[model samples]
Target chain A: MSEKAPWITYRPELKVLDCTIRDGGLINNHQFTDEVVRAVYDTCIQAGIDYMEIGYKNSPRLFPKSEFGAWRHCDEDDLNRVVGGHDAEKTGLKLAAMADAEKSDWKVQVVPRSESVLDLIRVAFYAHQVSEAVEMINHFHDLGYETMANLMAVSNITETEIDTVLESIAPTPAGTMVIVDSFGHLYREQIDRLYKKYAAAMEGTGKEIGIHAHNNMQLAFANTIEAIILGSNRVDATMLGLGRGAGNCPMEILLGFLRNPKFSLRPVIKLLQDHIIPLRDTVEWGPLIPFNITGQLNLHPQHAIKYRKSETKDDFVKFYDELKSEI
Target chain B: MSEKAPWITYRPELKVLDCTIRDGGLINNHQFTDEVVRAVYDTCIQAGIDYMEIGYKNSPRLFPKSEFGAWRHCDEDDLNRVVGGHDAEKTGLKLAAMADAEKSDWKVQVVPRSESVLDLIRVAFYAHQVSEAVEMINHFHDLGYETMANLMAVSNITETEIDTVLESIAPTPAGTMVIVDSFGHLYREQIDRLYKKYAAAMEGTGKEIGIHAHNNMQLAFANTIEAIILGSNRVDATMLGLGRGAGNCPMEILLGFLRNPKFSLRPVIKLLQDHIIPLRDTVEWGPLIPFNITGQLNLHPQHAIKYRKSETKDDFVKFYDELKSEI
Candidate 1:
């Protein structure tokens, strides 16, 4: 792809997906209050966000009804309460929900798009789970919902594995192939290489590339911007980066860089100041050193998250020692 | 220039400069305790940083002795107390200090290299002050100290003005021409353009391009990494990103990225935990909304700094309104 000077003009095809409630819920077991979810939904409308990912479509049996909140399943009533009955035709912004490959009971759980509030169903899966992801996407597509096949933990996957998965996903009904930096380990060069590879693999398939970066090494915004510059049309961000383990790219930062006239940063800033910043006391996320270590090592952030929650959060040296010993 | 994959191998020519005390001092008026300064010095040594900028050579007459601390002037005795003495040959790391174009009395205040502990003199100048900066670099070069001509507030300079200044700097003895993002307004694409511009301007001069970024928009580290990826060898960072309105890139983040076997991150982390984090209580800095606004508008962060100090620090909308009115 040619290096387009992004400042000269805006890319109308570029779509931003705010996954605050869905991703942020992972930090607090999907127990967001109606006020918080409503605030984010309103902010999305005012900020001109393309898609607001309300929550997941996972099985309540797996997550348990009492342990997780309504967002864990995104029951139509719960979503309707937030958006005041999601009228897809009237609402300026579209709604999306995540459905993991193995964890989600898509066959029984996901209803037709005409019957549901969600306009999109993003199917998240690992490299080995591409077949299941394809099935999930086909199912979602047959239901008339825009679908994305998000390959998770991509930094840990090998080149051969990634290529094989891309080939498998090429003919799937999924319209977008997401470059998920699950560990947040890859830097700009890696993002560049991956974007090129994904673009080349999806050539003539009418599929667009997407980016979902974690802020582990504090490069989520940078990585997202890199993918956008390299021609990724879909990007994922969370308000104030409130996802698990250092969070995803902050929506405010993404809006600030997009320079699109339609996107208003003021509402996003207001939401951050009024709603998201207050969550800092109860929720823990951001670029802590342990997270950075795990991100740099291309390891899962689970150990880092556990260490962060432990009483010895300040003892980075000991954590580093333990981490290296495991390696 | 063709894009080279940095992940294939580490850039051996890259040099990391830690300017924690000098930059962080802006937040606390250069009044860092001797203990803190010495701790940073020790950390820099242990962390295997190539250079440590202790402070500035600014004239006390301009800043006033009573108002600013010893670091504002960087008296030989004050520097000697930290380094013990200038023994660049014996010490693995070299000591450096900054000198603003008109703010510093470089001709008389800067002593001969043999009489000082400093191994380098970095002259910071605005676009209009390149002549004075050139003269300062010449004097320092003559005095047997390595020199760098840092063009401050590069995001605000016009393309024509930048060309004229770069042309003027080509003949100077300064071994490094720095792209200083004084306002921190730039994005990755801008950094790429600047790096390419600096590289083309300094072609065949045997001089290296350096990057000094502020964290106003939380892009300092990303911009620094972009510059490095595009072949800027000399990069500046501070511990915990402690500096003015926003701050600089965190040294720990930079060291973690370098991938050099000799660089140890533990020392930087320990210093942050022991020394820098405590300073946050008294000195406010980092990516606040007001600072980000100024950075985005390509304006000096003085007004944002003042707004942050006042009782209305929480009123982001008010600040935005006032900032836009002034703009």
Candidate 2:
């Protein structure tokens, strides 16, 4: 507190994105209705959020069924129908979509090959596929979409691989470089190390940093806090942590720490009441105690998410018996 | 990446206290059934949670609204019945209560106070009454309840004022210091500074740090993450994030991050599915975009919380027009 500025010395001032709908839609198989999507986009616009991701526009031909991919938004035309022609007053809100590296062939991912309904294109790359993602980001960059490379499973990557990838893209004109926690398993220390890595990689380049967090380990919000505090310009979140598996960092939680008041917590509450609440009746996405203990133990929580679903019957005793031998 | 030790590190090992029943009761007027309470207590026990706050134990005699304040197990006898004789094997949980420094008399706040039943007694203190809370913690300590001073609405206090009050609790006995975000408005930097204050004010002493967060502006979980990363021992959350106004941190998110396989995400999911989902059909919690904006603006969210509840057809619309100004 004495020498360095406070922990919040650096944060993004340009714009924010609430991914509750896009990321959260993963939990429900991307089945969110147009009405719900419309309301979400409307609120994002009214709240002055700079971008609202309607859904993934990448062609289904790109994804391999074995890879466990979910298209939070499946159709760009449908997305455009919902948020495309909002009154002129809602102008600055650009639509965005996400695509994985292993999935879509970049050439086929776009619907209108020459024209993009979306303003930005994000390439979410598995750690092993940074090169492919780089090529895609370059492709998007060439296509005039504000390109970004969202490196996934970052905690598992070595510095040498990270350096190779960064050195490749450091000179490219990608708008921003993002550190995406595909597994939502990072601590403040991990984020600090990662932040400095990404920051240093972009040292002389003209680009900003973006963070996408998963809450599988409950570090999503904390990790985001650390990233923004360390000078990252963009932070992403979903409503109610609605993404796949353990979900993404919650947008609502981020609202609490963002030093500004341009956003409203009311619409989020309303969406909870109107859409999110109803979804909870049918879908399940939240934390469990075994996962908490595992976090305490520095273990994986996916097994707990599985165990919870299996615990309702006399199965708990058997599951324990089986896992005991391996656990 | 070369940094050996990060100043702040989020250790997911902290214990989580889920008060969904008690806090959700705020929205539901304490309407939890015995089955629901029993199920939640039992699940948390199997999960190895440290604290299961049954409900408000403040004597109904302390308030004119006795019926309203008697929430869940307010009396020691009620506590015994709800948890079933405090066998460590069954619930394996210690009980806690929210004792108001101003509203609760010592006798009413702590009945049959002893380590045998309730293990922790947290004294909720308004910014103006830290001395009273200190006295209460001292008394509870003498009576055998592990006590803490939960400084509330801390966002309103000046550093100098907090320094004076914290100085009174200097030499804090084991487990007697806390920094509570009553308004849920404090951001990352505020928490960092405050935690530093708490650590400096109680260095070398046996006191442990506790964080009780509100979701007024949706920062509860985020701030709790900061607190944990900065080295606090306990973090407060509620089932489904149920509490006053917005609510507290969602225990599921905490547990999700904890990463223990024994602590199933299912029970928490089931709780949400069976308890919260239907309840949400009638009540709402979570960050609304409008409220997210207000929090972004660094303004109090209570105004938006109030405005959104208006029964008037166009109330929210009318309210939104004057929102950024009224607050």
Candidate 3:
């Protein structure tokens, strides 16, 4: 991707937020060295990225590495080092990290103490764990960190389930509630409807709206574009399409589409050629045979991911048939 | 891209066209093997692609192998051999190809000869040479092919220049005049202004609007999306972003964003992994160094393409500075 682009019209409504070093770390055992993290962080900043989600800032001592949702490399000192060197744009240069709902005392750990460390502390919740996530969101608001309650595994979730969660979050003070396309299976109209519904529910709630997407269906980039176009303020991406399975939305592509000169592509490309590509040689994130099969069958993606990694091609076909027949 | 996609609501007003194999061949010397062409054609059909552009149809004698924009290996037989095998959909599958304004003689060579061969015959013109191009459009229209006048190098053209050409095209039975961003330079706002103006102007004369975009600044995809969102119907793309520098708009990505199951990504990705990726490894068609510099500096892309093949990176930077300083 070029930076000194000619007269091509850049969409002003589009905004790019890079989570390459952060979200991409999931595939690499959450292992990004200091230099690699610094390079990715600094390059993303140079690439005119709107926000840089450094990593999840769960209290490692409380949640421990053994627990799920405690995203690695998210201690205060590690985050401080990432966000420190960028003497860059003041506002919208947000630092985000995620916390789990089932575990972790967000009121005690995330609110008061983590304020100096994070600008935004996102509370990720399973369908049934909205209460805990809401508690954390409120605590972050009281502590003054821009907070978002992300509804995770939305594919498996029901509308009533989400509405129940929204109803609980209706009176919160944080910025927004994000539609996390954890499965990355959504198309344009689905996102449009979701954005509209969420926007309508949060209209007078004082919370802003955001969307985080995965690229399972390759709709992540376009879906994010649509969300922003329809008024969702924040869009998330990882460098070099890095994340679990097919990876998250690409930050570089988003920046170019966003057309803000503030976002550059060189650093992102440099990161790709230097770090992401090399990682691909080892870590491997993108369309897999099983994932591809699920995509072909038009079935739920989790089943595809699970079957592909475990079952033979014939077995996967049988599984797809069985699921279809059952449906 | 997957086929077992979750249910999505698509904007009813939107329709997506995929031209990957056809336009992508510009860089492949247009000599793609029969298997490659067949698979691409089949994939487009499976993907439920609205329009599938096959290749150029012109007099083989005039467009000798030495000249550019010749039909390559693409002739009437080629279109039938590839597209003829598919289970043609009532969704309206149209085969399209390009013809040059100054070259390909439409009077005796292309018009009557190609009517039975292809569904649409598009007359492509440079910014300064649109008047001459419109003549070819009239001939193709007379021959019973859906005729389109693609005003090429349009980023360099002003509205008055377009108007001058439009005057002649208005009288013809030309079905459409495509806004060709041949230079890959126009921004979103510029595209919006251009599309609205052209669509409105053409409505009076009664012509559908079409668009062709290049991705020098990575804005091609977004620009097309924006144009479609705003109302333009006809869109173009190539498989694997294959074309001159930085390639054309990506077909798979566009289809993924489109609000239709017809554009299901399974077959598209399968062909990509099977055919397009191999081609890309053997051939390069993305951001070269010069396109990168121009994209960064927000300069014109056509200049960058010529510069990339001719000059060194250092020289390109010097050239970019010279161009920028002048601007």
Candidate No. with top lDDT: 1
Candidate 2 chain A lowest-lDDT run of ten: A313-322
| Whole-model Cα lDDT of every candidate shown, in order | 0.89, 0.66, 0.65
- Report per-candidate TM-score of chain A alone: 0.97, 0.83, 0.82
Could you estimate the TM-score for every candidate?
0.97, 0.74, 0.76
**lDDT per residue, candidate 3, A134-234, as tens digits?**
77777777777777788876656777887887788778766778888777666565677789878988988766678888765455666776777677777
Q: Which ten residues in a row have the lowest lDDT in candidate 2 chain B?
A: B1-10
DockQ of every candidate structure: 0.58, 0.18, 0.12
**C-alpha lDDT of residue A181 in model 2:** 74
The TM-score, computed over Cα atoms with residue i paired to residue i, of candidate 1 is: 0.97
Worst 10 residues of 1 chain A by lDDT: A1-10
Instruction: Report the C-alpha lDDT of model 2 over B1-327, residue by residue, as the tens digit.
Output: 114653322344566776766667666566666677777777677666778777765545554453463453366656666664676445557777767776776754575454346777777777688778777777777887777677776777788888887787775453857787765667667888889998888887777778887765546776787787788877788876777667788776666555444455556655665666566677766555445445555556566667667675224335555764665
| B-chain TM-score, candidate 1 | 0.97
- For candidate 1, give the docking quality class from DockQ: medium
Worst 10 residues of 3 chain B by lDDT: B1-10
TM-score of chain A of 1: 0.97
